[model samples]
Target: MTTVALVNTASIQERRDAGGMYHHRTNFDKYHPGYFGKVGMRHCHLKRNQSFCPTANLDKLWTLVSEQTRVNAAKDKTGAAPIIDVVLSGYYKVLGKGKLPEQPVTVKAKFFSRRAEEKIKGVGGAWVLVA
Candidate 1:
């Protein structure tokens, strides 16, 4: 018979700063406090705020498409409606919140929630994943 012993060594401690900001520290690393320190790759939107997590809601997308369409229509002399492309390369995730657009729009993003995919398809729109 073989016997194995397991030991738990992981620990987390809450810390408060002079500026009144609360932080957490793990036993492994004393310097960096939270998961924000572990994110190495930088996205376009992340450049603005290190702690910013982007979530693109459907309503926002709809508004963007409408605004673009309006601008394109204004430029057209023959009153032709041009297809609108909503490029969301800056966003990390697209959430299915609020109403979808009446017109079909092509959305390009990194990740999409299940509900978001359904909403886009339901509105005769298409979505593509970008690297």
Candidate 2:
């Protein structure tokens, strides 16, 4: 009780405070914290597009073709093939992963790979750029 009696003149509760808990920590940078850099006019907002672009592949499209079309090759029911439309938003590019789609499907995306574009068009499908 003698230690508290010394500094308890102003306020008895104030003596318990051990302030500056984060003083001079090694990892804590005051000026330059995490994700640092002057972005644009306000140094807070970004001037250019900083979002990452998502991608799509042709092998994935084949799964849909197999689902909506007559996939039973043994039955030989390949009459009046249905052209399926695949709408992919937030995807910048469509890649052909060394595999071609068996059926025609209209792909709506921003960009298409050389192989993917060729393969889609080669099968009488369409690639509509949604820019």
Candidate 3:
């Protein structure tokens, strides 16, 4: 079965193919990925923001900052461990959804829930907002 069959190729009238904007009828492989500019609208629906990001809880944070099976902070020459540096880079939203570390653990993040901030301060921990 081929699209170039006689019935398809020998049409009597010279039918104009539907215009290119007729996306619903277009073949999937016919896309001009580079030919189009600004392919989508910002309106008509809410799309996720480029900065929409992951959330961090205090309990999880403690694990990242604490050493194995002990109440001490993980070693870092400049600060906390490298694994936890992403939160400090202002991409994570921290929440007080889990236990706090025994020792004060300084953290830097873009956003912190009210409870998280309070808990951090309450438990002798410090938090700073990243720019």
Candidate 4:
């Protein structure tokens, strides 16, 4: 699996300019930090349409998995395929042209739009909070 380690703009530029060709270096980029100031860098792994940081909080990630799983289950039951979704830092948010069903869905993070939340709830969906 290829992992992309994102770093602060300035640090990445500096590393590039300094001819640091090694993919793994002793230095830690400000944007993405290494584990314990030692080995094991926290890189972003690309899975499906989601980008995941392996070292992030597992509780946060559990919520995304739950959401995606729920969506998949809904699709399967309704004979519709799961949609391409975007995930960031253990949060998954979908924005498309069509409206979503009003079913109860337990999401862990803060949603950005009330309209989106309401739309989801209106279709027999409840926007629940996951502990």
TM-scores, all models, native as reference: 0.46, 0.51, 0.50, 0.27
Model 3, span 1-131: residue lDDT tens: 66854566435433544344555335523655444457665666667675587887777775554356232343333444223443654447888897775555667887889998899888666788775
**lDDT-better candidate, 3 vs 4:** 3
Q: Arrange candidates by lDDT, descending.
A: 3, 1, 2, 4
The reply for model 4, stretches above 4 Å from the true place, is 1-72, 75-89, 92-98, 102-104, 129-131
What is candidate 4's CA lDDT for residue 15?
A: 71
lDDT of candidate model 4 versus the reference: 0.44
- Checking candidate 4 for backbone clashes, the offending pairs are 102-123, 102-124, 102-125, 103-124, 103-125, 103-126, 104-125, 104-126
What lDDT does model 1 reach?
0.63
Native-to-model Cα distance after best TM-score fit, residue 108 in candidate 4, in Å: 2.6
After TM-score superposition, what is the CA distance of residue 105 in candidate 2 from its true location, in Å?
Answer: 2.0
**Per-residue C-alpha lDDT of model 4 across residues 10-119, encoded as one tens digit per residue:** 98787766633255434635444643345657667746544432222222323444576756657666644332222344454432224544334433333324655565
Model 1: residue 25 alpha-carbon error in angstroms: 26
Clash tally, candidates in order: 0, 0, 0, 8
**Tens digits of per-residue lDDT for model 1, 1-131:** 99886744342222223222333334324554563445667565445555565777877775655566756655666634344344443566778888874555567776788998899888666888876
Better of 1 and 3 by TM-score: 3
Give the top-scoring candidate (TM-score): 2
